[model samples]
Target: MDMDVRRAAELARIELTADEAERFGGQLGKILEYIDKLNSLDVSGVDAMAHANAVYDVTRPDESRPGFGLEKALRNAPRKTADQFIVTKVVE
Candidate 1:
């Protein structure tokens, strides 16, 4: 698990000093060792997600709903003309 700190720093767009690299190397070594330990777990007879317990709520039926009046709604607009909102040109 020899992680090239230089390449890691280059990919992350950061500079790592020698002291930092040494510290990171030790930390990464421990992490990889722990991962190797996890890989040795005996789960051949285990049922995956046997502890998971959750259920979705029943969805209600969809129905058509009445809407507000267009003319009354447009009456409150700051800028509206010809049944359309008067806005600035979006394209040049």
Candidate 2:
């Protein structure tokens, strides 16, 4: 487990002191033990699911409505042509 900790730290480019290595090695060992315990469980009768509860889209339905005209939409523009706002060239 200590070796695993050292290898993982090396792969992650992390510098762990001896004390930190020992502490983390013990923690990792406990986590792996718990995983092993979970693997021993009998889950054959259980159904797989993406979520524990049913999920549904709760958004309001889309509805078209009257919109502000071009003049009102561009009322605050600092620069505008006859029919549209003029913006600085962004791509070229």
Candidate 3:
């Protein structure tokens, strides 16, 4: 490492001591090297994919269904009106 760890830390809004910066700079250099190696690989025929493995969503079609009415919804309320649950007015 010759990477500018201090500048990177500043950009990331992180504080790093001299020792920590040196250590992290070396690690980041290694990571960049690995990325460069990966980039050098030939894959002209491969399709671009979002993930390494095949992924799919198992889903069902959305359908409308009947639901409980206001009376049933307010059945357990301590106080309620004909079509709503009643609560104390807190805002003035």
The candidate scoring highest on lDDT is 2
Per residue, candidate 2 scores C-alpha lDDT tens digits across 1-92 of 13499999999999999999999999998888767777788999998899888988898669887899997899999999987989989998
Arranged by TM-score with the best first, the candidates are: 3, 2, 1
lDDT of each: 0.81, 0.87, 0.84
Q: Write the per-residue lDDT of candidate 3 for residues 1-92, one digit (tens) a residue.
A: 26788998999999998899989988999988777876788999998989988899888778877788776777889977766778889999
Q: Candidate 3: lDDT of 80?
A: 75
> TM-score of model 1 relative to the true fold?
0.38
Q: Which ten-residue region of model 2 has the weakest summed lDDT?
A: 1-10
Model 1, residue 43: distance off in Å is 9.6
Best by TM-score: 3
CA lDDT for candidate 3: 0.84
